[model samples]
Target: MSNDRREPATDADERTMLEGWLDYHRQTLAHKCAGLTDAQLRTASVAPSTLSLMGLVRHMAEVERSWFRRVLVGEDAPPIYYSDADPDGEFRLTEADTWAEAYATWQAEIDTARRHAADLALDDPSTGRHRRTGEVFSLRWILTHMIEEYARHNGHADLLRECLDGATGE
Candidate 1:
């Protein structure tokens, strides 16, 4: 007989449920990026399009870190991908770096974001005033925003990865 050891789902398992969904999405992004070389991951398929597997990874890293650490936690510092002079620097790859470095950088950002989220209650308020609009929101809103941001980018990553080398799926 085949073995199945999955835990039974319970109605009270809200935390586990949220985490499972979050993990599934994160894994999908990672799977889309699997088995890609540095050049393949970094290459731009069409002119004037900044979308690439590596660029998406970097972009998501910036998103996660910016929302969870900088905005939610109210860090008095610049965002990882934001520069006053060049706002598009996150999508622009100006250097030829190793694949390992790219993946490691992404992983590091993901880890930090996860740790920060785990430590905070979702209802926790943002520490600083928003620059764009004068509004206040809880960390819960930030996390949900991150999920939506990732979902959109992951879809783009799916197409970009397929175009890079015919790879497909989450």
Candidate 2:
């Protein structure tokens, strides 16, 4: 996906606006990593920081699964990357982690998330409760939160890509 982000329609309804911006940010992350080799994808931003393009992909996959499948759909979905023993496992790359696998997983999670939210109303409350607050969130809240999550991470991706190859843009 190139950095040709779709401008969210200013006159669109709330749902369309949220989904549009979310997809824009999603594509932004992918565009940042495009044309990079596995080694480049795994290259960390700086010493003592495990953040990398590949790690962001894996982390987003987990985030998608957690919010859409586990929380929205109320599925007993488990973490695909991290665990209780290593809460940041997605960011902690291993020799076994491959770009192909992480990319596929991230795409799959995005697809699943779209499906889960496609038929739900914005005010529909999630079946699952927040892990910390024990409060159920509406679909609207989840969508807004997901947008914020992607936008924040995409900023990091922007800098990482620039550092990696001197490439920079919205």
Candidate 3:
């Protein structure tokens, strides 16, 4: 309940609302991981599940890079974690993985994403196509999808944090 996340404005314009909600969710994820030790950040939620706060941060970095840099801006950015050989590479933490690195990478990706989308119209089509459908997406669609993605993962983060400690909030 000690979160610093800003609630999205209910009376804002469409673009404002979307960006605000996305940022709110982003801050929510950060809040969930704050004040945790390295071990706590890397600790898996439960047996047979490798989902951890650190992993989520890494995974989100890859996601932000993929959607914004690779798709939206047509950059040749590659995945930072997962690949064909290991699709869940981000989630499979190694001894070398550190919260500092993961958080930095995630923050960098967020910054890049904001920069790439800053002046683009929401209706503008992405330069890249979906890997499966070969269909191009609009910035609006991508933004909405990102909001959904973060919302889902933030729920998992909520559970993870609760398990790690006793913290819970909206």
Candidate 4:
């Protein structure tokens, strides 16, 4: 099939535009790991940080699960990649945590997020509480926050990919 990165369409409505950009950022992260081996994906090429391509994949999967399944859909979905004991577990991958599993889980989370967001209104409130303040949020806020989150992490992924092998672009 086609190996093209999807650019967010500018002419769409607010919700559609948000989804498009979010999807674009998601695909952009995957693009950074294109043609790389699992070791390459797991390598913390940028020293002094625990960031890696594989870790990003896993982290974003958890992010998708948290916002869409747990918050937006009101499903009470539990954490997937991290725990209370090790909150950054998603960023720490062992040899056993292969890239295949990371990518598959990330894709599955993305699929689930899309399905959950499909029928929901932007003004809907989430079922989850804020970690620091015990506050609820709207679906609009979740979508906006997710886009910002992906954008930030994708920036890290961009640098990590560059340090690993110089691959770039969304």
lDDT of each: 0.70, 0.92, 0.92, 0.84
Report clash pairs, candidate 4: none
lDDT of 4 by residue, 73-157 (tens): 6687778888999999998878888988999999999999988888878888777776567778887888899989999998898
Measured on C-alpha atoms, candidate 1 has an lDDT of 0.70
Query: Could you tell me the C-alpha RMSD of candidate 2 in Å?
Result: 1.2
Give the runs in model 1 whose Cα sits over 4 Å from its true position. 1-12
- Please report how far candidate 2 places residue 17 from its true position, in Å: 0.5
Best-to-worst TM-score order: 3, 2, 4, 1
Write one digit per residue (lDDT tens) for candidate 3, span 75-167.
888789999999999999877899999999999999999999999999999998766677788999999999999999999999999999999
**TM-score of candidate 1 to 2 decimals:** 0.83
- Model 2, 19-47: lDDT tens digits are 99899889989999999989899999999
RMSD of each: 4.2, 1.2, 1.0, 2.0
Q: Which window of 10 residues has the lowest lDDT sum in candidate 3?
A: 1-10
Per-residue lDDT of 23 in model 2: 92
Candidates in order, TM-scores: namely: 0.83, 0.96, 0.97, 0.91
Error of 3 at 66 (Å): 0.9
Q: List the residue pairs that clash in candidate 2.
A: none
Candidate 4 Cα deviation (angstroms), residue 84:
1.4
Report how far off residue 46 is in candidate 3 (Å): 1.0
Please give, for residues 1-170, the per-residue lDDT of candidate 1 as tens digits. Answer: 12122332566365565555565566677777777777887887688897777777777777766776677766664656558887877677855655577678778877876786787676778776566785666866776676677778789987887788776655
- TM-score computed on alpha carbons, candidate 3: 0.97
Better-scoring candidate (TM-score), 1 or 2: 2
